[model samples]
Structures are given as C-alpha cells and as structure tokens.
Target: MAVPTVPRLGPQIGTRLMRRFSSCPRAYSYADTLPNLKIGAHTRVLFQGFTGRQATANVKESLEWGTKIVGGVKPGVEGEHLGLPIFPSVKVAQEKAKPDASAIYVPGNQTADAIEEAIEAEIPLVVAVAEHVPIHDILRIHSMLQTQSKTRLVGANCPGIISAIGKCRIGFQPLPCFAPGHVGIVAKSGTLSYETVASTTRAGLGQSLCISMGGDVLAGTNFVDALKVFEHDDDTQGIIIVGEIGGAAEMDAAEWIKDYRRRTTDPKPIMALIGGLEAPTGRVMGHAGAWTAPGEPDAQTKYRALEQAGVVMVNHPEKFGHGMRTLLARSLSKSGTSNTLFGNGLQKRGYHATRRTTLASIVGYQQKRSLYLKEAQALEILKLKSVPVAEGDIGSNGLICISIDRSALSPCIVASSDPESDPRLLRRIPFSYGQATVENHPMMADLADQLKIPSSSRDQLGSIVQALWEIFKEKEAFVLECQIGVSADGTFAAHGARFGFDDAAYRSSGRQEEIHRLRNTSEEVPEEVEAEKYGIVYVKLQGQGSIGTLVNGAGLAMNTVDALTFHGGHCANFLDTGGKATSETVKASFQIICSDPRVKAIFVNIFGGLTRCDMIAEGIILAFRDLHMQVPVVVRLRGTNEELGQQMIAESGLPLHAFDSFEDAAKKVISLAGPQ
Candidate 1:
C-alpha cells in the first residue's frame, strides 16, 4: 500500500492560489517581469542571518562567484562581515541595502522567522535553504506568502536557485556541473539538478537558469511556477526537469507542456528524469518529499505523463546527460529545427548500446538485394588526470584523502588513509562554518615543534596549504587535492595533483584559457553526484486498493496501512500532513483523497499531539463545503483538543462520522469501502 508524503500537487495548489489571492488576484499572477521566480546576474541578493557562520561562508562564496550581494541582516550586529554592511532587521536592511532578493541561511527552527521577515520587508524573491523545517510552520507561512504580492519564496528546505548563464548563484549549487546555454532546469532533487546540467552541458547544451525546488513536503515555488518563468525567459530554448516519485506536480507540469505546445508556434524542447524508481516503500528516504503518497502519481506514471506531453525522457540517472544529447540529435535530424518532438523513435536511450544478436536487414521492394547494417561503436575507457577530481594530498600528508561532510549541517573535514575507506584510520575534524582558515585548518599543523615535523617541511606544507586554500576559494572547487613530493634536501614540490573545481568558475575566473589548457572537460558524469534532500517514502500499490488513509507522521502512516490491510481493508493512498497540520493542509488532503476513484471511503486517524483536532475538524467542514464529496469519511480523533474537535464535528451536522473507538472507525470505513 502506497502511504503518504505531503507535497502540494499542482492542481490542488492552484486552487489554493486562486482563493488566497482572490482579493487582488492579478498581483500574484505571472507577469512579464516574473518578479519573484525569475532572477539574473543583475539580481541583488540579501543574506539573512548575515553575522551567522553559515551565512558568512555562503556570502563569501557568493561574492567571490560574482553574485551581486548588496548587504545582509543579522539582529544585534550592525557592523560588517566580508565588507558587506549588516543590519538588525530585514526592514532596516531593505531600506539601507535595497536588495532585490533575500537568501536565508538560518536553522530549520528559525527558518519561519527568517522567511516572515523577508516577506514583511517585501523582498521580491526570498530563498530559504534550511532543511527539516516544521511542516505546520510552512503551511502557516506559505499562507502568509500568498496574501502578499511582493515576495516569492524558493525554499525552506531547498538548494535555492541559480542563474548559470549569468554567473549568479544564491544557494550552493555546484558550479562545475553547469555551463551557460539555452536549457533551463527546475528540479526537486539537488543532485539530479546537477545530473540534468551534466547531461545537457556535455551535449554542448548548457543551462540558462536552474531552480532547485527543495525536497520538503512543501516548497514556496514548484515545477509549474519555474516553467512559466522559463516560458517567459527569452534566453532559454529548452528545459529539463528532475523530479522524484512524490506528488502530482509532474503531471501538472505535463499539462502545462501540452498547453505550451498548443499555444505557441514554436515551443522549447523539454527533457525530464524522475528518480527513486527502485526505492522501497513507506518511510522517510533521503528527502521529505521524495516518496509517493496516496492519490499521488508514481514514478513510472510520471515518466509516461511527461513523454505524452512531448517531453524527451531520460530513462536512467546514468543515462541522463548522454541520453539527452542522443535524443536531441535524433530529434534535430528529423525535425530540422529545435522544435523537437521525440515521437515514434521515442524509446529508452540504450538501443545501440544494448547487447543484441541480430543486425537490421533492409530488403528492397523487388527483393533483389539485401543491405545489412551492423554497429561500430567506440570502446574506450575514461583516463585519469583528464578528470579534475582531487586525489589525496600525496606528500607529507601521507596519501590522505580529505572530504567535507555536512550531515550535521556544519563543515566537518573527514580524513582517511584510503579515499574509499573500509577498516582504516579515519579522523573527523568539525569546525564552525566560517572558522576554517589556512592557519587553523584541521589538517594544517599549528606548531611545527608539536607535531615533531621538521620546520622546513612544515613551512613548505603550510605554503602548500595556503596555496591550495587560495586556489580553492578562487576556483570555487567542491573537491581539490594536491600531491606534494619532498626530497632529502627538504625541498617540496607539487607533483601530479588532482583538481576538481566548478565548470562555471573557469569561465569567469579569468583563468579559463589556463584551466582549459590543463584538461578538456572531465569525464565526470554529474549523475553520479549524490541525490539531494527529499521527503517521505511510499510504494504505490498497483492492484485494487480502496481505503484512503489520512494520517499524521510517516512512522504511523505505515502502521495505519498495515492495520487496515490486516483488517481486510486496502488503502488507496497515504497522506502525511506532518505532526502539525493546519486546516489548509487538512482540506488539501481531503481534496487529494476525494479525487481518487478507488477510495470509496476515507479513514482519518489523528493523534493530534502537535496537530490540533480542531483544525482537522475545520478542514473537514471546509472540504465538505468545497469538495462536495460522494464518499463517506470516518473520523477517529485522539490526544490534544479531541473534545473540542468532536463538539465542533457534532455541531456541524456534516456527513463526517466521529468515532471514539478505533475498532468502530475501522469497521465503519472497511464496511463502506467493501460495498459498491
């Protein structure tokens, strides 16, 4: 039984926008300016939590990368960090700095505060990169975001947005994966965004803009929102989407694609990849929004939906870049233009590469001659040193490979004897975000005498470390390694070093020609990059599943499915509104559940510790009024505010039946589901 994860499905979310902005609907509409979703190299960005360690590092990177950072906001600190002025509040910073957008680098707990401040200041675009933000907070703030006109938020748990062609990066999207071209990208998974760029860039089709719609159950901006911006942007000739298993967003995007094809004389080409196909069901994977919920579209269903809309499909992650290049070549050959409809010949991209015993034989109409065609494909492996990926620093460091881990949301340097460590000597050195310096780098020895290193070698190593740091910052490398060799005289020199830096960096880094001279494009497949942060997990049941379970929390959603199935009941879908579901989310859940034909009845079981039953009650009333559902709904409320919720439900006189006992509620839903 496919359980639940919360993502604002496109259609359902559209309904929300209409109502929220009904007061002055035109203000929120997508205009030529794309006031919120669209950004460029010229966009002025503000850093919230400016004095913060993470914010400092990000601001430093952004400034170095050519992002037009006006200033930042951090309460109780009005001085400057990195030569940018700081203010106590967003409003003050807005008045002084006059930023076009706001980039939030605060914790999940403080995310709402940061976003609300940006919204109140009327920041044109707000980008939040914090992860694991409370869903209820999102629901609340998302509502607030709608009522206003001036602000459009990118993420609460997202990688943020980047304009690759423009050289403006708000969030920490890898620069090496991007190249300036005509393809615009919007994706849920961050790593998949890299994959999309990796594919398109290798094809010599680079990105105009790429927006990372963070993998939370909810995001301020979604796939459709990004699409409209792409449609409007003159620079973009094509688009690529990286979607996961969760939500109806992709289906909604397909509808938009179809509409775009119908309305425009020449539509931009689109390529898409949906991951999490082999993912297991009913739990939190890497991301909060990566899982399929009840009544939501599955990965396979989404893939076909996109293809039906004239989108070129990427069959696998590894094939994303190469497959796209292949498909576009085929499309261009037939159409003679970029209005590429990958029709008829549209199959998964490995026919030539696949092992086949037979060759195609072409016979003439007269049967006079037969022309047999075989294949001649390249058989070569990728060479090392051609790729810029770093090897361990080889000299006094003793072949130690170093990497940065951010699992704790802080920079922790991982040092190991083996690059791919098993049973090996491993050391983790975690430091404050902005604390690592050439002098204080964990690997860099503080006192030469303390480590018993010869003063000459230590000084040489320090110089190497300083040089590496300078190059790292200037080149914007995600990973870089240098191998140094020392002789008997203690004179050390760099020998056969490995380098992995941003592809975009060299372009603007003034050393483009020099870097190019070092190596051509590395054979690094960006698809191999790790998958980005996402939401809950669910395995969509293909057969006859009936009962739609609306529950709070991922852990309990699975349990509900198990119990229902054990009781001879099948679940049509699972929707987890999180622990703190508001009335808006509850109504959305009802809308989603009712839209599913298989769900004859709904069993809403709420524990309500963080969730208020009163809100659910209110949502039930709203759903009945708005949705006008045919199916019966069984309500089982427990925990906080249960009595008031029951009273409200009882007084409403709606068809919703509230049961005190789980047995009664289960029996009622099961009976209703079993019948016609």
Candidate 2:
C-alpha cells in the first residue's frame, strides 16, 4: 500500500537556481528518504536475493548486529535462510513479513529489476548494494520515482543505512565503527562513511543514523533529500555530511542549508567532509561519482560553499567527530546567547552576498533540458545516459581555470582566465532568461577595463560570451571547452572549441549523424578503447609504475591507488572489472595487469558487496596458473564469500599472498616491489 508522501522541503532552492543556472527547474524535490533511513528496532526489513551468497553473508552480519530481519525474497528458494521467511517475490514477502524496508543484494545488472520488484510491491524503502548498476537504470528508476512517492531507493552502489540508536543496520558498515548518538551522517562513499562513523563514535558523540547514499553519479536519494529528514529528527541534533568531489550535490546542499537556515528555527549544526580533493580531473575516482568532471565543482568549490553556509568544514575524514562536536557546542552557545553577532541561528554567509565572485567554481548550464542536470550532469556520462546533445560542449581552456578576472564584481556576468599562464582567455558570461538579453548589457567594456583587454578584442570577448550564453540557454549543452584568445596587444582569436551534447537529447535531435561526423576519436586512448570492448575500464598511467590494481568499485580503485601512492608505490594502470565481474572478465583483467611490463607487483583488493569474493579469488588463481606470473600479487578480500576466497588462495599455492586488511596488503605490495 502506498503511504502518504511528505512534501519535499526547500522550494527556497529556487532563489539560487534563478540566480545561476535555469529559469525552468521543476520544483526541485526528491522523496524524503530520511524517514526511511530512520530505522528502529521495530522496523522490519526484507532482503531481496536473500539466499544469494552476498545477501546471505550481509544478512547474517546485519542480524548479528541487531537489525530487524523479519523476512526476505528469493524466488525458487523454499523455506528461510536465517530463520526469516523467504518468499518468491517482494509482494509475497511483503504480505507475509509486513516489511517496511527491502534491501536488494542482486548483482549490478539485476539491481534495477530487483528494485522494480520492491517498488511494484509498494515497499516503502529499498536499499540496493550493487556498485556496477548502469547509469541508465538509475535515470529510469529516478524517473519512475518522480511520478509518485511510494518507494525510496538508497543505493545501487552503497553500503546502505544504519540507525545507531535504532539498532537497525541495513548495509555492510562496520558495526564497531558506529554507536547510538546525536549526529546524523549521510555520504556517497561507503568507505568514508565507515571512517566518519568510527571517528564520531570514538569522539563519544555516537550517531543518530548513517546513510551511505552510494557514490554512483546519479543517486536516488541526494544530500538535500537526506538533510531534510535529519533537520526535523529529534534524535539528530547535528549533521555530518560526507560529500565527494564531482557534481553539484554538495553545492546544492550548501544552497539548501543557506535557505533552510533562513527559514528554520535554531537549525542543527552541520559539519561536512568532502573526499578525493586531489583526485585527477579526468580519471574516475574509487567512488564512482567522486572525480571532478570538466565543468563540475571541485572539492575546494564545495568546501568553500559549505563553509560559507556556516557548515563546519573538515578537510579530512578523521576530523568529522571533532569538527561536528565543536560546531554543535558553539551553535548551542550562540543559541543560548541571542546578543551574539548573527544571533543564535546559523548566520547567512557572505559567499552569496559578496559582489566579488573572485574564485572560479566550474558550474555548468544546459542548451537543452532533459533530466534536471545539477551543475550539468557529468558530460562524460551523457553518451551512456541517452540524453542527446542539442549542442556539444567545446572551448579553448588554458593551463589554469580562472573563475573571474577583476570584472567578476558584476553579479550579472563573470569571466575568468589565469593571470600568470595567459592574459588571453575565453569566458562564459551568464545572460538572464527574460528582459536581460545579451544586447541589453554593455558589460564588455567593464570586463575589458578589468582584464586589460586591448580595444580590438572587446567585441571578441563580448560576442563570444553572448553567443555561448545564448546557445547554452536556448539549445542546451552538457560539456564544452572553448578558448578566446586575448593578447597583450588586444588581438583576439576564437580557436580550439570542443563540445559534447547530451546523448538523451540526441534521439529527438535528428542530429546524431551530424554530431558523429564532427567526432574526434583521434584523441581516444588505444588501451582504453581495447578495454571497453572487453567490458572494463582501463586507464594506463603516464609513467612506468611497479604496481597494478584490479578492484571492483570505482571508489575502491581510487583508494587503492591512494594507499599504494601513500606507501611510496606507483600504480601501473587502473583496471576496474566493474561491479559484476565473471571469472572470465576477472582473468582477462588480471592478464591486462600482468601484461604491463612495468608491473613488478599487483594488488587485488576486492570488497564484495554484491560481487562474490570466491569468483574473484578463482580468477586470480586461474590467471597465475595459466601463465607463470612474474610479479608478486598482494590480495585483500572482504565482504561476501571472502572466507572461501581466502581458503582458495591458501590452497592455490601461487605467489598471491592474502591479507585481511587494506593497510597490510598495500604495504605488502609496496615492499614486494622493492624500490622505484
């Protein structure tokens, strides 16, 4: 039965939307998922794929940690797996168990199907753990969700949620790392969520609820969705938002926080930690959605936004506990003393109020409307998203991305270029939807004075910004990098423009052939091209390195590289078999790593949530047996079927040494590599 939906909060988000990106944003709302996240002892939970190896393992752990596992769904399986009734479908299980929540532990490809089953059954809340879920599936699932608000999905690639006080743990987060307390946590990175919980728990603050929203590019439940729930919960007095780089979720959260502070009474303090600040722009991070895309805000942008929102910002994960604790106390102190500057409630930040938008924040706007692309959904994923490009993204980018040159003082328009790298630069100036046409404003003269652009190039900068903004607002674009040259002498050349349009928009565009004709495949990496054919992502590093990593999830892969680098080791390549990997694919990936002649050592780190551990172990063994391996392989396995995986490695007698901890395994690989 569909339950009554809570009206999504923060219509005030429109204030910011109007100022920046779009005139036509639908009432920006998502299901209030925090209520679902508020799992208590009485909240009966049902597991889909209950009898599967991964699900079974996680269910046991959840049960052991005090989760209310009333029943599960497993078609063709009779009886129960863990003293809980195992029905054939979510509907049957729902009827029997009367479950309020359902967790799907199916593989990545099947995650959407399982979620649909739960949704169709009217399951109020669904938590999915597959990391390799297709982006298209999430887009479809989200579309289905917007129609009505019966079902709320958490992760197709997350650890799930846990209520420290409720004693209801849905995901695979470390139990010891969490404790019942006053802080509510929401994050996209499962690994970081664990660290946040541990830090907060150690600080003696405990937690109200911890939500791993999954690091997929498009999350079913977002930062605002979770924050709205926490803002009202009595159990949650403060919030620790663990955000990752990439996309505008954090920035959006900052906006919502600013609006929420303006409206709410004595709002709880929020402390945030954004991960992968140093991650390469083009390379995908361990968390699937953690990397900075071409036009998305970087970690610093998000940090500044959150800081300006009165959120206590912590640069590292370990500071989560201390930071929130201090912020909460400080907030309390202010609340009691109204005479304090800015009163008791969180003060409005000058970030938005300041006329000078000095620093550059890579914000994206579209040429054509499709799904609400916040900060323009990553231009990289649009091809697979099926959102067609009305007009492609192209620009001439210099070595540095400068946010604003002196003329940035204007609220209506902003232009940027590196002062040191090149005085000549190209900029996208914002033009409003109504009344304020490009011709309406002669801001180019002001910008020219600020940028010291010679008289000859004033028209050049003015025309380009106007043209780009008009194109962006009218047709819509996903990503673009353009260059507007301005020399010391004021001469100008608009060269080096590259653009990519939303593929989902392309189907209706009837311009697919024309766009394809403008293709620039020459810049494509050959090894990456080959890996795509094999259904994997392979990005070889620039320099010859000794270690190669074969990991399951994007976040895990990036972290593995971080750990290796921290241990004075360099990774030869980033080879991800994706969320669901067969023995064939795993063996193939292993071969790819071994083929890298620079690889003196290989590290196999598999955190099997839905993906099985034994299968990965089998692939590693088979690869070594098939070809006498020249390098030592350090293996670390956890999660589903990990015990069997470890036993397999023990029996195989290959040079693969298995460890239970990431630190130990990383150290082993680094040591085995013996020097640079």
Candidate 3:
C-alpha cells in the first residue's frame, strides 16, 4: 500500500466543475455545484429483461462503447450470460452489483412492471425503450415516480439518453452519430435527434448529451425537463430542441425559456427545429404523439413562438447543425469565448468556406415575380362573363378588391385565373387562396350552391370545380372572386365566371373541349374532394358517432376524437376554430358542429396561445344563447386567461359542463352521450 498509492479522480472532476463555473456561474446553482449525476463511464448500469433480444443487443453494443454494464435482471434466468450476472430481481442484483441506473428492455406489456421494480430498487435513473406501452400504464408509472421524487425516468417509448463525453449509452441511440462537445440535444423524436446529432457533428459541433424524450402522447420526460437539466449541466454550452407536431411541450418550453432568459444574466443560447411543416392537418405522422390538433400549435406556430422567445429557429431539419453552429459562434463571440474549436471542428469535418452567408440567404430565397392580371382587367372579365361582381375598386397592384361575404363562406376556397391568355388554359387556374370565413359573403353562397349541385348530383364536384377553375387562367382577365362551399352541405358557388379568353381562341386551342370533357366525365369523389366539400379542418372517419368535436387546433381536435374513440365513443364531425378564434368564428364553428344531426353531444376543447380563452368562452356563451344549443356541450379551456374564461362560462348560466382538463371534459361528454 505504501509502495503504490491509488491515483484520485477528484482533481479531474474538480477541474471539469471549475471550468464549467468559469464559463457561467448560473450553469451550476449553489445546491448543484457538485458534478451532475449522469450516465457516464464510472456509472454502473443494470439491464431489465437482460435475456431479451433488444436488451442483449443493446448491452453488447454498450459494452463495446466501454459502458460499465454491471449486471442484468430477468426472472427465472439467474445464470451468467454475456459474461454478466443475471439475477431473478433488481433487489437481488443490487446487493451483488450496485447499479446507478437501469435500462428497461421488457415488452411494453411488462415495461411498467420492470420500471416499478427499478424504482423499488431505488435506481436513480431508469431509461425505458419499450414502445407501444399502454398509455394508462405509463400514467401509473409516472404517478409512481411522482411519489418517489428521487427517481428519474427517461422514456416509455423513447430511444434513451446518451452522454458523448462520458462515452456511455443507456438506450438504443446510434453511437456513430454523436461526438463529445458542448451542444446538448433534446428531442421528442429519436430518428430526428439522430439526424440532428449527425448534422451537428458534420458542422464541427459536438454534443454534451442527447436525450430522446419519447414519442408517446404521455412521455415520462418532456422538453422542459431535459432543458432544465442541460441548463445546469456544466458540460453543455448550448441546447437544441427538435420538436414536431402535436402537444404543447414545445410551446411550454418556449415560455419557460422566455422566463429563464429574463431571470438569468448568462443565459445559454438555444435553437429549435420544428418538424412537420408539410404535414397535413389531423393526420398522425410517425410518432404516436406527433399529431397536430386544431388550434394547437403547428410548425409555424411553434417556430414563431420559439423565435419570439429569443430562440434561433431553423426552418429545415437538415440545417439544424448549421443553425446551431452559427448560433454557437455568435453566442461564444458575444461571451468573449474563443471560437477556435468551432473552426477546428469544421475544418476536421472537411468543411471549407471562404465566406459565410446570412441564414436568410442560405435557407430561403426571394419569391419570383408572379404573372399579374390587373384588378380592373379581372373586373371587366367578370362583367363580360355574366358573373355577379361586388362593387369594389382595385389596389395599385393586380390583387382583387371586393366586399368578401364571410358568413356564406363558413369555409371557402378563393382562387384567381387569367380569363384571356389561352396557353394551357386549364393549368393556369391558381387555386392558392383558401380559408375558413368568419362571416357570410354572397360569393360564398353562390360557390356553395355550385358545389352542392355537383356533390348531390353526380358527386363529380371535383371535375366541375376544376372545369370552372380553368376560367381564371385565361389571359390578362382575372376571376376576382371564386368561392367553393366547405359547409356540411356540399355546394359550389362562384361570384365570377370566365369566357375562356377569346371564345374562338379557346375553342381553336382545343382546351374548351377538354374542359367540357373533364366536367362531363363522372369520377368517384376522392377523400380530398369530400374534405373540401365540408370545411372540416380535420376528420377521422370511423363511419359512426353521435358526438362531434369543435376544437381550437387540429392537434387538439384529433386528441379529442381519439379520447372519445378510446372511451367507446364516436365522433360525428371535426370542426377546428383555427388560429383566429373570435366570438363570431367560435359561434359559427359551434353551429357547424351542432348542425350535424348525428352529433348529439359536442366536445369543445380550446388551448389558447394566440387565441384568447376568454374570447373562445365568450363565443361559446353567445353561440348557445343565440342558437339555443340543443346538444350536450362539454367545454375544456386552458391557457391565456383560462380562469376568466371559465368564470364567464359559469356566469352565462348555460347548460354546459366546464372542466380544466380535456380528459375530464371528454369523459363527461362521452358519459352524457352514452356509448356510440
């Protein structure tokens, strides 16, 4: 012992802590001044369901990464396997080989039990990789952790956490995609996180930690939880949040970041990349929890929210690394930290650039000049075509100026066309403008009539709409107003008509014949056609349901429908109030939902962000007062003056059940309506 004294790791740990403190004192609160407890080289891991295929493979890979996987747990498999001891239970294993953390690999059905076992063993950290676990089970598991506050859970359906600096792995994240550095990655998506990490590495930025917060609707951890950890972690200098559609987690994080920045002097620079910009509304894309609800935050909403919160938002996923690199460079420069590491990392990654372009130039380009048909020309063409035109003047530009009837067009598709030019007549119709109306318009009524005729007649509304749309593409003549019905009733109406540029020219070009042929040809209505027919923001066709939903966002609408369906209920229709939920809009939305004979009960879920809850509640109260709402209504209001909204609803003395949670409101509605 006197001849050979053991070398202490204390100085090494102290040096790391000191470096972290030197960078930012706020990084480590006084209570958390000691080194953060994370899965690292020195931490021993216990594998739950070790004999399982997923565990076996992951353990082998972890061991290859030099992770200290001490033992495993698998009932009735108490024998040595993979050179690691297998125990009957976590308690028995803890007595022999103490594990600081646990990696759960049991089937989803048994995942909750395994997690409970780990918590009972008092393991500080538990990473659950099992997907498709029953949501109820996860809720219970989370509840269990709440009681035992010391235990931390990573995921229920996530890929898990990785510490690049520690060279330790706790989940199934690909190791090659990671590098040890200062940026911390927190995401609800596993594959997206991998892509982000790879991009960061490519950009010469390494990560301190990468956490996949799981894709389940109810994950054990969220963006804020992970962000708080990264905020205090000494190793992490910056943070990147990769979020997608569905849930208010990202929005919540943005709000937290706003407060965090306001409260702290040395706030870390944060960047966000929100996926699903192109994702269609109401559809579940990829992750189980990645569906957007009506009025719920979409990609654009999330982007704006994060940006407003002072976070750098990357529009495209591929540019995450570039965004982070640029952000970190700026942050470091502002903090007077040397950016030599960034340059060296980029150089090592084989990146060479003589000059750096602005992010706006790199990510987005200016719009190309559009072909214009002056408003005066468009009005003259409408008059020539025997189309009814509202009294209105024109702007200096070619854009149409008319009194739009918002009421008739509850939801309308507005398009423009040049009625003069004959080149590829049908292809020229620009049906770009589409939206739900807040008031009734005459053009909307006409449009609704046209759509209704085709929808009820041959069900060839698409062909008719297409045929009519070609009128807009003519020449210098534009169709000022084109409206199509999005009401429950199928109808199409148009305020303006087209006489195919010069009739002789249109006839000679053979486009008129093609248009006629398309209109006459009866084709089965596509799903999109149906969607367009009714201004339904989102709809899931179960083919049966007496309950309908009037929700704020598409994500919330979908969740409401899901909750109803899960509780043995059915949805008659889906109506989203969209982003601008004014009293009139909300009233109109409720009327649409209640109009459906099948809808015996209505579930109104509004999670206000830009749309104030008080406004929504006022709308509901006014709608019921005016319409004498016959259906049972369950309303759940949260966010932005929610209490005031609730009080307003209560004072209105309407026959409405108001609750704080969507789950409770949904359950109440379903119970009142009975099983569909």
Point to the candidate with the largest TM-score: 2
Off by over 4 Å in 2: 1-185, 190-208, 216-220, 224-242, 248-278, 286-288, 293-477, 484-494, 501-523
Give the TM-scores of the predictions, in the order they appear: 0.48, 0.57, 0.47
Q: In model 3, how many backbone clashes occur?
A: 44
lDDT, candidate 2, equals: 0.62
- List, residue by residue over 1-676, the lDDT tens digit for candidate 3: 0111111112212343223222332232222211223567777899988988868888898899888899898886689889999999988988889888889988777787787777667677788987656443454454344333446777877878889989888998767667888889898766556556766887888899888778765666678777888888899988989877766688889999989988988788887666654344444443445553212345556656776788765433345577677767767677532323233121111111122232111111110101123334444544554433443322111111121111111112332223222212212111111211212323433343422333353233333343333343333111123322223332222332222121221222333344233221123223222332333344434466788777654434544454455455677765555434677766666666665667778888776543567888888898888988888888877655778888888788888888875446767888887755
Ranking by TM-score: 2, 1, 3
Ranking by lDDT: 2, 1, 3
Candidate 3: residue 592 lDDT (0-100): 63
Better of 2 and 3 by TM-score: 2
lDDT of the candidates, in the order given: 0.58, 0.62, 0.57
